[model samples]
Target: MRTEANRRKINRLYILGAGASYALTQGQTESLVAPLDIQFCQRIKDLQQRTRPKWVAAAARRVEKEYLHHVDFQITGLEELIRQQISDYEFIAAIHPRRTRGKRTKEEYLNDLNHLAAYLLSRARARDQSLLEKWLEKYLKGTEKRATRNRIITFNYDTLIDNVLLNWHSPQHVYFDNIWSSSTKSPTRLADRYPLLLKLHGSINWRCSEEEYAKLFNSAVTTDESKTTTYNTKDCHYIDKMWINNRVCTPEEQETPLIIPPLPQKPITSIAIFRYLWTYAYEYLYEARNIVIAGYSLPPEPPRVSRRLQLLREWSHEQVKQVFT
Candidate 1:
């Protein structure tokens, strides 16, 4: 039996950033994956060395020709250069006529960029003794002691947090846009459950129909076993393996994993799933009493993300009792 006082306690919201994922490396040089902004050229070069895909090679050449030609290496990183290219391409597309030949379109560039990012992130294997799991346990224990309600909002696309939560509790407890239930039972909305986890930037494991993207955002639960899809990061690895083995041959097979790349201006409002995530995040931030920001620098370059964070800070300023950064 729960007490009335417990139900009335303040909610705690945690904000995670790229640095949060990087910190999980625990100073291990071999297992560490470089952040978006660091080692921009080297990452591309390494990817080129690993794979012989024409698109990957073409993407590298484009990056070198367009960005590395004149920019100061000390000042701008890969992420910044990529953002600038995307922005410039967008501007050109909006004003001038679409060019069919000589250069790759903005969409093609973005596709290559996303594929490269996914490949890089997927290669990062967790160590035998996980430090992330231990850290999360202690963090959760402390948060539960002070707050009645707790939720996580992560900007990073990695599945480290997802792995921790799923391992800690039942699959139903960890909600990413979709709900989960046993094969015998119907799924339920994440809001119906306590302690929700929202991925703001999306995840590597998430995939949906490119043609029917909005359909993927539907919250209606399914009871039919055939229709019920298992939401696990490992499932993503399986899909990747199938693709590599030539088992995935059809167009539908190739476009299964739908991931949103790390860009300055994300199409959150345009996409149904992202829009819902942002709305959910805003609601939580507005009602939260404590906001714990860990390892997130809140970079000023990304307008969409920065604007939302600014609004969250403003909305929770009066109600928030404490802010831990």
Candidate 2:
């Protein structure tokens, strides 16, 4: 709950990342560790060692300097065996240093990435819904002034925010679409009065469809009603169904495009749902006055997001306030 004065202030925007929700969800600090890509690189080096590749030795040394010192320096530190497979002497060194000798296979590496991604996202989603539900109750119950004029803009692709707001009986209140046409001015329609949640990168629950928006709305609402899991708490269930057909495929099975990765790419094929989301993210930024950012690293877009954030910073002049809180 906010103070009466703060509640009366202008609409606020919230930017969240894995860390933000991870904190609320009781995620361990070690869970937030990086060196994720390095996990894959190490595996590559291990495989190269057995069947000496042209670049194995050099790559191993470079990887050691780049990352191994902090984690595994013993094998990498071996003056002559840096590129060698598990020689008898090197094997002794590996055991002494408590480092695994074989690098994980490609498939194994992919599984590791997926496991990390899933754990991080699970923690984030759980926390995201908890916070959003608190604010949403305020909006629905008309508890505060700021709650009446609030919207959320996040880089996450999780369905936590979507499920909470829609469950609050105001699906129209949350705006997920991105309208790109310059001529299309912002509408002061009934939905505009409701709180908006623009997921900039995209979300797993949403799909590109040829179906009418009305049908989609009805279907979503129906699904919302069917979900018996509680929201806004660690006890809440994970909405794995949100992902394309409830699919959490391995790297090889991830043939279709994705929106939840560390980076995002424009789908060459037409994905109407994604187009709508990307458009609305821009719109949310355009209309926002105060943006609250938390744990998000602003990545550059060709002519959007990053540049817009830069311009916002330059022109803010105390007009817009970005707080990590």
- The lDDT leader among the candidates is 1
Tens-digit lDDT track of model 1 for 101-194: 4676655555555555555555454553366667566655343334336778887766667767666654444554243332234444443333
Worst lDDT window (10 residues) for model 2?
229-238
Q: Name the TM-score of candidate 2.
A: 0.43
Off by over 4 Å in 1: 1-10, 51-78, 90-102, 125-129, 138-148, 170-172, 177-195, 212-253, 262-264, 300-305
What is the TM-score of each predicted model, taking all chains together? 0.67, 0.43
> Could you give candidate 2's per-residue lDDT for residues 92-197 as a string of tens digits?
5556644444643322322333332333343333534466577657643343343455566665555555666655534334542122111123322342332366
The per-model lDDT (C-alpha) reads 0.53, 0.40
The list of candidate 2 runs beyond 4 A from truth reads 1-10, 27-132, 139-147, 170-195, 208-260, 263-278, 297-325
Candidate 1's displacement at residue 193, Å, is 4.3
